[model samples]
Target: MVAVVVELLALQVPENGYGSINDAKVLAFGEMGFGIFGSFLVLTLFFKPLVCQQPNTDESFVFEFLQKMGLNPPKDYGFSGSFCSWRGVFCDDKGENVVGLEASGLGLSGVIPDTTIGKLIKLETLDLSSNRITALPSDFWSLGSIKKLNLSHNQITGSLSSNIGNFGRLESLDLSFNNFSGSIPEAVSSLSSLQALNLSHNGFESAIPTGIAQCRSLVAVDLSENSLNGSLPNGFGAALSQLKFLSLAGNEILGRASDFTGMKSIIYLNISGNQFKGSVVEVFEGPLEVIDLSRNQFQGHIAQVNFSSTFKWSNLLYLDLCENELSGEFFTDLIHAQNLKHLNLAYNRFTKQRFLQVDMLTNLEYLNLSGTNLIGEIPSNVSSLVSLRTLDLSENHLSNRIPPVLAKNLKVLDLSCNNLTGDIPLMLIGELHGMESFNFSYNNLSFCASQFSRETLEAAFIGSVNSCPIAANPDFFKRRAPKHRGLEIALVLTISMVCLLVGLLFLAFRCRRETRMWVVKQNSFREEQTISGPFSFQTDSTTWVADVKQATSVPVVIFEKPLLNFTFADLLSATSHFDRGTLLAEGRFGPVYGGLLPGGIHVAVKVLVHGSTMTDQEAARELEYLGRIKHPNLVPLTGYCLAGEQRIAIYDYMENGNLQNLLYDLPLGVQTTEDWSNDTWEDENNGIQNEATLVSWVRGLVRRNQALLAIDPKIRGTGPDAQMIEALKIGYLCTAETPSKRPSMQQVVGLLKDLEQITL
Candidate 1:
């Protein structure tokens, strides 16, 4: 029977097929092969379980994807069993397909390769955020099943593609803190299911797409810190009824506070740092928990609004209306906002009033009413708010002694620039060590320095009278004794004049070396230096500098007028020894004082604050740069004096006063007398024009391709016309309606550098 089967197999094969078999077994090979195949087929059918296992398509695709991404799969993802067991990998109930990947903050880099991640057709949630990914693969947009996509905090660039519309099921999309530019694609509105969309901290420009109003399902939308402009789209607030948290801050969106009336569910609304103006009452119509309308032009009083009908005041946890044009009495109804933790109403033109009736807001932790024209005594009722941690009542006309019963939990206290008088409370003095910031400067308050450390005294009282009784201040007798002792003062004055003449003669030759050496030492010192007193030979006048920091043995180094030699003694006498009466302004860096030198030269001395991290070399370099540069509009850096840790820069005093006074000191709609008397204030040569008009003029010229016409005639032929036009275009960009739309100073420099022959 075998021989018969072999003859049949041989007959089925080609004639040449037998040559490839062993020559010795050529005749019987067909019979043996037929028997072996039949036996093996029968065995495999019965024992299939003994065969080796291989992964399914989903597992193989996941392995390949991870391999291509150069990612090390979690430890549990061994070369056996299912990938569903791996960390950050989610699978369906069947464990057959990948459904989600929470691979955020992984060391993922470069482009997401094509056909790798997209191959996971069942993927729903993918979080690749906080990576170094620069671009997406071509097939990435094909992940139609994705419900949540988070690629935030990455290096992703370029416009978000219209192809993103393919994510029909996406519920949350976070691409914030990326370099994505260009207008937000209108196709983003196609994601009908998207509930949370965050595209903040990007370079996105142009008005927000009107189609975004269609995303009625959006619950939270944060488009802050982008170049978005124009008005809110029609039906934006009304259509997105489900929206609760919306932060369009740091943009230039123009609209009234009333525009948000339809967002009935808005619990957290922050439209700060925008160009939004007009009355602010309607913004409280929603049951809001947090409301930040700061840095806008919102005006009008809140007294007329019925807080009871507007919303649940108890639900309001945070409220910031700072830097607006709002006026009238403080919101007495705010007492009803018992849950409010923070309240900032600073820098507004409110009418003079008594201390805030905030004793009811016991939960208030932060309160700032600075620069609000507040008057009367700070009510002791404030002490009832035991949770209050920070309180700023500076730049107001408040009078009388600080309440002894201020909140014990208060960590920050600023009562500067007030008429507060009387002795400092022992309670506050005892709590000095625990306070983070305590300023009572420019006040009539007196405090005993016996218990307080020199650091505490200097830090707390810069411009205080400090006229404690002899029992409180041991030096009180010594300071007052100078007035009665005429002969002692005369001898001191004589010696000071002689020493001043000698020091003047000495500094005239080596002033440069002395200035540089003193500056270096001032910058190098790590410890705080306080100006305890002036030179022994100098006058006894107590100036603002006396309370500042310890004095150093260095002369005032005049940069522009090197020959105008003056010792540190001269600076003391020039500004009445840094008297608080001569105090001009409390600047961000420090304080500025107006003084007159011996040569009838009026100068403004700015004192750089202590505890700066800036290196000595950097400080020196900055000073040198400022001294070398001269601009017609800028105050010339006349000189500088280093007194230990304190760095003082002197500039030619402007009789016209600082910018704050020029802009805000007068009443609204009132022009400066100079504006009427001097037509030169409006002269185009001085680059003075209505800011809006100038922007419009330049924009028109640029739009018509005649930007060169707006350029200064002197610099017209200096640089290439193309470069000039490009530079003008950048200037136009800087004057954008919103700060977010404006290029950063760094970006502007980079753009200018890209242009040939363009000078900044």
Candidate 2:
């Protein structure tokens, strides 16, 4: 019988580690007592039920509970076998009485009806947490045998009932993360056997009930993130000597540190985000593993505080004292805490020390000392801490170069807003690729162009200088100021004025030459027109126009000039009866021809040929959708026409021709000299190749770490060098030799946007 009862308890207990070890031990002892009594009751009742084959009273109660709560019973064992066969249901040794039911996270909803679960007099453990249950029946408080009740993470509302004190044998009660409001009932002091109470993340307000001190068996209490105000109850901590975990964080509580002195067994204490003010030294007297006193008004000197715990090896693992008024030598008192893994002392006013002695705490994993006003070089021995992963020393006055060797296990390092100078080490640059975060911005440090690429350097270090001038030029410090300073300044000014005058004259001369060339070309075109005779179109008969109108009756739809009312006849007349002389260009989608309408509005007409797959109606609909698209960079589709097999689209003519012609067709006698587009290299087979495409040439330069050479001469002095380098990197990725490796157009646009942000 004992074995069967133990198995039932094991199955019902949550697998998730919910409470501290001390809470578990106390709850375990109480549940064991319930199991023994249940076994005895079954043995005494078994002898009286052998002769009769009557229905079980416990099974009937469980069935009523499932039905009223809209919970489904198992298909195979639906009222046919013992209720123990159902999932999350447990029965006593005789299988005649239901004792445990775990229906957590089942998405159960609606209010439970009265007289359903209340009839299970033998039920000891009931867990219906993580559901949508809104309310409980009035009779639920009558379950005297329930040792543990968990209804957390639900939408249950209304103030807790005073009748909750009827659970005299309840050992653990968790109603946290619900919408329960109003002052906690004073009748909760009646649960003398209760060990753990979690009422956090709710709307419970007002001062804590002083009557809670009567429950000396309390082990863990989490009342954080609520609006509970006022000071702690008298002797609140002195009475709960067995408490292991106590958290009142994110509340409006105000109390001295001495109120919590008697918690000898406390392991984790978090009272941060409150108005508590006092010396924190008294709160450090426990076998603590975690202590968070941050965001409070505590003031103390670190040398006077005791860093030792009750354990021999120092069980303290995390300590946060940031944003307080604490002062003194920060690390001197922390040497005894060898097991400390996380320490945050930022935003304090510690005395400025020339050298920090934190190398002794080699087990540290996370450390933050920003805004503490420390002024000195970071000690080189900090690299010895092999377990260090995150370190923050920003907003300080520390000067000198960074230590060459940092712990390779570092994943986050922030040293921004400091006076650190000199070139960043190449080793640090190599390690940046794997780090999650690294910031050296707002410092005097410089990065080498040869070692750092814009792709590898994250934006966290954006404000650092891009070029390492001292390293590139060995004689940078050797140059001295001239003794004749005034004479040197006068000489430089005169030379600059002369250069400026000469440049203006050269620009004017080139402008004059280009104008003369345009006039000569215009005269030659006129001479050619005269030799070919006057151009004229034959309009001998209007029968051809009538035939065109008969072939296609639909009028041309114009977007800009809607009143033009052009037809297929008017288009044919403007294009000189579709003569080849009016042809402007030929493409895959038929030919484009230039035309002048009757009102002297110049337009370009494109003939679309989609074959027989697209009907004329479908083609007209598609053209209508295309005509609505309007962008400043795109030519507007002015009108469209459908004439039997051909689909005509008319657009506003551009005086500058197509993009390819405007870009490549330079004026005559102009030479491409020093522009970024003039990229040429000598190949072994071909002496000097200027015909190499821009993408291929830039790719070679990027591979050799000379991406800066591809920057346009005109833009080099106009924008930041880092933005140019990043732009080149994007170009290199877009022009990868492997077609599949190249980035899509969408990704390319995103990269360009990032470059623009850098420029800003």
Candidate 3:
């Protein structure tokens, strides 16, 4: 059935924004209807041409399965096209048999159908992950030839039956992130060719199946976050020699260090959060890349030699020994694990020592030694961690100003709660233009608050730093934000200076055409040319594409004298060259990014998206016009930048997010009188707001009559309900479609005041 879809998706936006529906596609249709005489002639002239779907016997099963799933037409979808063309359905080499089917993460709900799925014996892979499916079809086990089956991240319950052995060819079977409980099935050991088994984050109880050792092909095993207890079977480790990744963390499994052995191929091992006691000596086999023994009862001093002997762990990259009862001095020369990049020894009782062995971990990117009891002058050579990105020495007794050269390329530096002393380093902060997070809280440090610009403080986590002298200064946040007039004056002076300089330069010799064009480019900022679509330029331009694939060379114009003279390059550098991590929000126009200008000024950069309808000149004009509207509550348009098709407007960043999001959070919709709910209201008071406990009585009760004034849940059903309704009435009147229905600002203000008084 050909039905029209009346979906009014575009909402009431501004005239410049709300798309024009008048530009509908001009479609013309031509249909030929056969007359009674023409039909007689066609019958005599020729036989009807054959028109039907190319037949495929194997596709019938899959087509029926999709029809049962009710996913075809969203409402009445049937296999109208070839079965191979269905979403998430894949065919074989000859395109005759459906081999793969995956509808994971598509919000599919309900249980699966057995008859249709059972007929698809040729299906090699089936993935229904991240759905609300609660159970599988009984006949689903008949797909014995399937190689991979994943029903993970669903609500699937019930124990896996011994019939799991039917899939003897299964290489990977993932049923994780579900409500499946009960003991591990012994039939799982029948799959001798199984490579990966993930039963983590489930309610699986009892011990690890001793029969699992029969799965000699198991290369990865994650049984963490379960209630599996008791010691592992004696031969479990020996049988998993080919295992590369093993996670038994977040369980009650108990085992001694000696009981685990002969897993040389294991690259990632996590036995943390278990009852794994005994010394860590000769524990891990050689060539382990990661070892996490944190939060366990591994007492006594670490042998140290096992983790730090040169040539011992040639491929070790991560080692975490935090939150354990182990106490000992760290190996001074950690050259044994030369490839180690992450080391955490926090919350341990290790004694103080000079940990300034800079040459040890030249490849280390993360080093956390918080509360490990290291004391003395900060390592002078600590600056040699050329690859270090994060260094957290918080909660230690180390006393000193932060090492200037330390973590030069660092993005996160945590030195809070230490015995640091002296003035905050301005040069260090200045050089740390790329720093994303810095913490110096609860320390003996003082500094002029103005030095830490808005961006710097924003970069610092809440309560990150302790006291700063400038924070108490009344003028700390009163720093000047360059005004629009300031840019105007600067533009004038720049043009005059360039003209004088060019005059002197042109007097030298015959100037080329490039030189003359360069002069036009210099004065082109004032020339509002409507260049459309994506363009590229360097140094300065009127508009640049919002999708900044490469570093932009556009000039950054400041509205006023900002704290620091930040250029486009500096902004790009602060935001990892405008990486996705820096993206704050995507709006109708373009995406907004958070950037740290020099002096730590946190600013929000709203890059306007350029479409075919809008040009560089129009965008520039729109931004300039919007920037001129200054009000008390308005977010200040701090500056603007243009390069090719990219037009960005920088504003004083509001930490709580922008206004557009707040409006969306309300989700205002028309609520007519007839559709009002008739149910008892429940206030925040803990009393029984409803009078009836019986279901019959509760069904008959009706809610109090109140207008549905959409407001944030934070203020919903509270005293603001009345106020919201009043304000919304005024808003609706102002945004009324008819000019005569719209009210003036004076009348709107009067109505709002009356509403306020009435509410009070």
Candidate 4:
């Protein structure tokens, strides 16, 4: 666009109009550039009056829906001018009709206004992603002309309808990161025109529909991060001849490694985090550039490729098989993967004697072989990987002197917990100009008298160590405080003693402190128990967590006082010191992290947001009270830690997370009779208050023998309808407008137990 603008500017100037170009000519050219740029921007902006094309229908419904949803766009975005000129609305080339609407990430919530969009017959693309969109109008999918539809990262729910196949010209559909559940609708699989289909990060279950073979033109497909189980339908892989990217990771896809021999066009494939039970060798040769088969149960061996004939190893950029049980030879075909930039074979049973000639991978940027049982001396030619940016050989059995060449261009190096033994290579340590992270801990290597540089010591260590100069040893623990001048020490001691005396006298004369203790009298004997700990959750310091860390490992304050005396060290170990990858979700309060505590107790650690309204003590008391409230659906607060202003709460991590995320995503944009009655009043003329109103109407309609509103139609017939209706009744009653009218816990529990008998 800038180039186009520059071209236009160049054409607009009159060559040699000013016979001699000078300072004034240059200033005039600069002024003309700004004028031309402004004119171009104005031309691109939609203006209804430009072609005297006013909207034929009332589009005020969008604003009214936004207002009802308690959302208001910027002040400039409203009905003050032509509706066509409003933000996110794009007009056609003739400037006579709205062709596109991209009002995503504006914090808008609630169901899409049907009246507003139903009139946009010419709309070819619509994006309402990354908002709080809760529902969709009945005919939301009626925009048949829409080729690109993105309603991802929202709170939409309900089953996808077969009617979607009617969008024969649609090219891209992204409904990822929402709460939409149920299997991928067969109609979606039949969309031959679709180029990209992303249904990842939803609650979709069941197997990949066999009907997917009908989407012959699909180039990319992402159905990851769902509850989908069962093997992929046969002939599904063979049908996607044009597929360039395919991801079904983070699901329960059970099968042997899928046969992709028919997929000659395959470029990027990821089937990681599934239940595929077979050898990693099942992968077929292809023109692939990236492949990830990590975090699975594939074992035994991998395919030994004849890279020179069967495949182009130079085309492969990334190959990961980490966290699997695959063993046997590290194929020499890897030597042919000279163009590979990233490779991970960590946490596997690759018990190779030594990775010889690994330096042949000169183009490698990242390599991870940790926990791969690599024995013997380090690869002699390891330095040949000159392009290596990050290297991990930790948890190995390698024993050799530090390779000086490997340290030259490396930004990150990890050789921790290895069996290497020798004096530190002084020259190698001195040549690391780009070293950002370097760890040689837990090795048999001796420390040199020269000692490591200050920069190197500042880097973090991954494992326990004894020889490293920076590692904490007996000497470090026994180090004493430096002596002070005799007169200064005497003066400080005298003042401290005087203050102590004054405080003791004041407390004795003016204060009356109470102590609470639990005494157990048994066999004519008594035992006194009282918790006497340091008391100062009182200060309003911002750096409390840091201060607590400086004083102790962790300040864990139990709520119900479990028998296990867990400490900060426990949490640090459980979450790898709250590693970034363990973070589950971030809310206004703070980040919630997933942690695997000792004994396999999965927990969620919520580090409270700083500068919150609650004080340190008040937060503790509230947390303790909250810990007492337990329910099957509610996550129970296990404990809390308060250090100054820092507050951290612990809870049992729920597998499926919250109800809002489980029940609905922002906007599935589904239009079907299965989820709604035939007489449903989705038209704006009908009075619709909120989502609760829809649920209530459905409840009443179900009572009338109308179709039962279902979020998943596949579950219908496969399960008892009575239980489904019963569950719907419970949900509707719980959302009653009058809180007091809702059923009590005892009634709800009884109702649930009664309905459990009708399960499939």
Residue runs of model 3 more than 4 Å from their true location after superposition:
1-58, 74-80, 85-87, 91-97, 303-312, 431-433, 453-760
- Report how far residue 715 has shifted in candidate 4, in Å: 71
Q: Give per-residue CA lDDT, model 3, range 57-124, as digits (tens).
A: 55556654554665544323323445566667888988877788887776667777777677677888
lDDT of 2 at 433: 71
Residue 259's lDDT within candidate 4 is: 51
- Provide C-alpha RMSD values for all models, in order: 19.2, 28.9, 24.3, 22.3
Candidate 1 residue 468 C-alpha distance from true site, Å: 6.7
Per-residue alpha-carbon lDDT of candidate 2 for residues 541-574, written as tens digits (9 for 90 to 100): 2332334445334567787666787778678877
- The number of the candidate with the highest lDDT is 1
Q: Count backbone clashes in candidate 4.
A: 10
Ranking of models by lDDT: 1, 2, 4, 3
Error of 3 at 32 (Å): 17
Q: What is the TM-score of each candidate against the true structure?
A: 0.60, 0.54, 0.54, 0.57
Per-residue alpha-carbon lDDT of model 4 for 552-605, expressed as tens digits? 434565566565667766776777666655766544465577888777878898
Q: Which runs of model 4 end up more than 4 angstroms from their true locations?
A: 1-87, 303-309, 427-436, 448-760
lDDT of every predicted structure (CA atoms):
0.74, 0.72, 0.65, 0.67
Per-residue lDDT for 1-760 in model 1, tens only? 4555455545543342211111213344565677755654454344332122234456566555655555654332343333576667889999888898887776778777776787889999999898788888888888999999999999999999999999999999999999999999999889899999999999999998987988899999999999899998887889888899999999988999877878889999999999889888878876899999998988888666555385888899999999888989887778789899999999887888887888678899999999899989999888888999999998799998888878898899999778899988978878877888888876788876577776566646855655556767656455556566898888999999999999898777544433222110012211111111010111122433464453434567787676777767777777777775676765446657888889898899887765135543345436755786656778789888756556788888988776656543433345776553223234557464643366666764654456788988988887577777776777766664433234556555555666765545
TM-score of decoy 3: 0.54
Pick the winner on TM-score between candidates 2 and 4: 4
* Superior by lDDT: candidate 1 or candidate 2: 1
How far residue 370's Cα lies from its native spot in candidate 4, in Å, is 0.9
- Against the true structure, candidate 2 reaches a TM-score of 0.54
- Superposed Cα RMSD, model 4: 22.3
